[model samples]
Target: MTQIAYFEPSYTAHNARDWEIRGSYKYPSLLGDLHTMAKITLLMPTLPPETDPHRIMLETNYDVRFVALDTLDDAGDANIESLVEDYATAIANLEPDIVSTLNGRMIGHNFALARAAKAVGKDFVYRIAGNDIATQIAVREAAGRPVTGTAYLATLIAQERYAAEVARSVIVMGGTERERAAGRVADPSKIHICRRGVDQSHFTPAANASKSCNRILFVGRNSAEKGIDLIEGAADMLAKTRPEIEFTVAGDFDPRTEGNRHYLGFHGYADLPTLYQDHDALLLPARSEGFPQVVMEAMSCGLPAILSKSLFEHDFGAGDGVTLIDRDVRSIVDAISSWHDDDSLFAKVRSEAIGQAKEHFDATENGEHYHTILLGQGK
Candidate 1:
């Protein structure tokens, strides 16, 4: 079997244990499927050490390895050279055929990992999860801000470009991302489109689920980028006209009980299915995104989504089961109100969402695509 080293710095010791305990399906499911085809080793940073590697491997049924780097704080200029050497040494020791990591920001741990992959003569694969870097560069250039100077932003952009140029293959989520990567990477042929998938068996439609669009759900960070202000504004406006309508937010933000808005704090992957089933519709007016898994999960559970028009630029929610609106409070309110008023529209959207999830976003089928890509068999 081909050996593959999957570098994911975000999965620290604590969170890795949490994922294992909660039975998080995203990484576990993908890694589990990939394990059948290749010898997969999950490479992560060495944190304060809470979880045992043997236990994690036994419980999660996947190999896990740790490197010297603990966090991004350790990747500063003061120790970057040493960090890269250390990472390269680790990679050489692993003797993997390919080195893969998520998001091509090329900062901190990612920067070190990319350089290390090249140093060991291994094929480096960069998986982009969002268009943040490209979008930021465009915004800076449009604003007449320098993107090539000694500024922090300029340096980060340069690193991102370098990473893209060096990687043997760049995996993007959709055609939109492929277009974005084409401009940065010299070879557009290396850019491949493979979207993340939803486990339809797990996130199924609720039994006898109420089609009433009274409960609105928002699953993301409470940030301006996520359009939290729009959600709150829409909720406050609906509180007066459609007082029965309620907004529930599931993320890391603090809980707030103002008007009809309610926060459920942070929810794990295991808790997401029930949360989606309990809600009537999913609303995410994010300014920018790359195939949000939340939307896929919600759709798999037969919940319709009201998204921002900008997300469609990345080809997300382009088909049925979604209502696209501008990034404003009124637009969001109007979309939710329409769902609440039109019973036929709600039913149609719900059915279409489930159909789309089954047809396009099945995790097992997408996993096969991912396996092919990793094995150098497909783009």
Candidate 2:
């Protein structure tokens, strides 16, 4: 079996059993399907010494060999030299034929892993989920927050450039993301698109449910980038004009405080299916995204979405099951009203959304594609 080392941001607890609990099983799902084709070893960071790095779970079917490294976290740590040495040593122990690292925070890890891969004469693959630099800048700009320091920003930019340049293959989220990364890479042909996959079978809507189109749902972080203010403002407007329409929020942040919106608080991954059944549509006016998982989840649930123009152009782009609108208060109000009143349009978008979900966002379909990419068998 070909030994492949997978390096990514460590999930909470640094184990496969906790991935579902953390609502971050994308990596597990992606790797599980590919395990049959290769000898896979998952190298995680920020785990304690007590963590059993070799533990394997029966649920994932991946049989991934876990190796925990304590030097991944630089949170207020001053010992940079020690961290670099430890990271390189931990990676070297794997003796991998291929080293695939997730492009995330802690720039030192990328450098260490790249150096180790080079030393071992192994190919390196850089998988990018979201650009931290772009997201941070966008969120701060959206919230009217001031920039803290240039040092951190410079480091983030450098990591992005370095990762793209050194990696043999670059896996990105979508077309827009590839375009953004093309500006940083030597050869754009090295970039590949592997969107975040969804479990369409699990997130399906209830059968034979009547359509009301009055219950609107917002699922994501309660930050400025997620357009919490827009949701709040739209909720206020819809309360007066379309009093029947109700808005519910489900995610890490809470937006309730003498308002018309109902906050469901932070829900686990399991609760999403039932939550989608109870809601009519997903209303998210986010500022930016690298193909949000929530949108894919909602579409899998056969729920239509109302997204801002910026998000629509970047991810959806006139896709079914979603209606694109600007970030104006009145635009949101009108879109929600149409979902309730326009019977023909609503019916068309609903049917198309479910079909789109299965075709584009299904995990089984995407998992196979990624497996091929990992094997270097496709374009």
Provide the clash count, candidate 1. 0
Q: Please, what is the whole-model Cα lDDT of each candidate in the order they appear?
A: 0.73, 0.71
Model 1 compared with the native: what TM-score?
0.86
Instruction: State TM-scores per candidate.
Output: 0.86, 0.86
lDDT for 113 in candidate 1 is 67
112-215 per-residue lDDT for model 2 (tens digits) = 56665666677777777765556777677667775456676776666678867888888878777788889988899989888758877688966854466888
Worst 10 residues of 1 by lDDT: 64-73
lDDT of 1 by residue, 76-98 (tens): 55666776787687678888998
Instruction: Give the residue spans of candidate 2 off by over 4 A.
Output: 10-24, 46-60, 75-84, 101-112, 138-145, 148-151, 254-258
Q: Pick the candidate with the highest lDDT.
A: 1
Extract clashing residue pairs from model 2.
Answer: none
